[model samples]
Target: MTTTVVGVDGSPDSDLAVEWAAADAARRHRPLHIVHAYLSPFVAAQVAVPTSGGFEPVLRAAAEGTLGAAVARASSVAAGLDITTDMPAGEAPAALLDAARRAALLVVGCGHAAMAGLLPGSVSRAAVHHAACSVAVVK
Candidate 1:
């Protein structure tokens, strides 16, 4: 089935985007896919450690929590909606674009004055330009 894909980063703006995407998906009878991209600090660490110990787990847990919260919020707003969540290990924009490839629509959150200045947030701007499907940026 066609899906409405939303990128969430545990921000209030992303929460708004989730709400908007959920409603649109419910109305259109499409599945709602909530995606969160997590880039572990280890990936950026210049020196490799024998083990990350608790650090990697903590980051993964937080990412899962963010996805869970978004799922809960979406479920509350649109009961009986087909909702799914993803945590891709990469940059937000690349993950969102990958999800968008098979989606009917891609929704992302933007901050106030996102477009008034020189650039919108990098992820939202990149998704707007590179997503395979139509993109909606909720502010």
Candidate 2:
């Protein structure tokens, strides 16, 4: 069966997307694949904090935690549903699009309307426009 793929970042909207994707995967009788893309510490440190030897491990741990929470949330929504997770080594939109190549549907979360005017976030917008499969932007 074609799997349902969802992107998560630990935000409230991401939680909603996880719930929606879990339910959809259950209804479709397909597996749910959760993806959380994180940048390399070298790149992330440039954008987030000062470069340090300890930063990489923290980034990896945070990404794993995000995936774990998403898995738990999805499981709560659909008990007994098959679920898998990934932490791809790249940007969010590209990773999601790559994963979507083998997916039945790609799901992403949309933050508050004020955050991006009338459009969805960059990752969601990219998926909505570029994913080979159907895309869902859950708010």
Candidate 3:
């Protein structure tokens, strides 16, 4: 069965992207996977007190929260849609591309307006160029 994947960074625009993806998935009757990739650098800055655990717990918690919220947002638009969460440790664009392999559609946010031509977030660029499936850039 084809699946839908949405890349979310917890930004308001990404939240909107999630909503769009969910609606599309519901219309297609495909499972939706909401992904939030947290790079080590982002996590390092997010954590002030370092631990041997290397910020796993902190990052994991944030990923869970973000992915969960995205799923909730999806559910709000389409109740009982098949939803899953993927919180991977990697660069955002690369992680999204990996997820795209099995996706029927991939959705991402254009941090800047489409009139800007290119997105403020690099993941949008990667998704446009490298997605193995259909791509949607929500501004």
lDDT at position 121, candidate 3: 64
Off by over 4 Å in 1: 40-54, 112-120
- TM accuracy, model 1: 0.86
Give per-residue CA lDDT, model 3, range 40-76, as digits (tens). Answer: 4444555543644666676678778888889889999
- Give candidate 3's TM-score: 0.85
Candidate 3 achieves a global lDDT of 0.82
Worst 10-residue lDDT window for candidate 1 reads: 111-120
For model 2, what is the alpha-carbon lDDT of residue 119? Answer: 39
Higher-lDDT candidate of 1 and 2: 2
Model 1: per-residue Cα lDDT over 28-73, one tens digit each:
9999999987653335353332246644566678889989999999
Q: Please, what are the lDDT tens digits per residue for candidate 2 over residues 6-98?
A: 988788998999999999999999999999875543365455644455555677788899899999999999999999999986677788899
TM-score (all chains, Cα) for each model: 0.86, 0.86, 0.85
Candidate 2 wrongly placed segments (more than 4 Å): 40-53, 112-120
Deviation (Å) of 96 in candidate 3: 0.5
| Residue pairs in collision within model 2 | none
Best by lDDT: 2
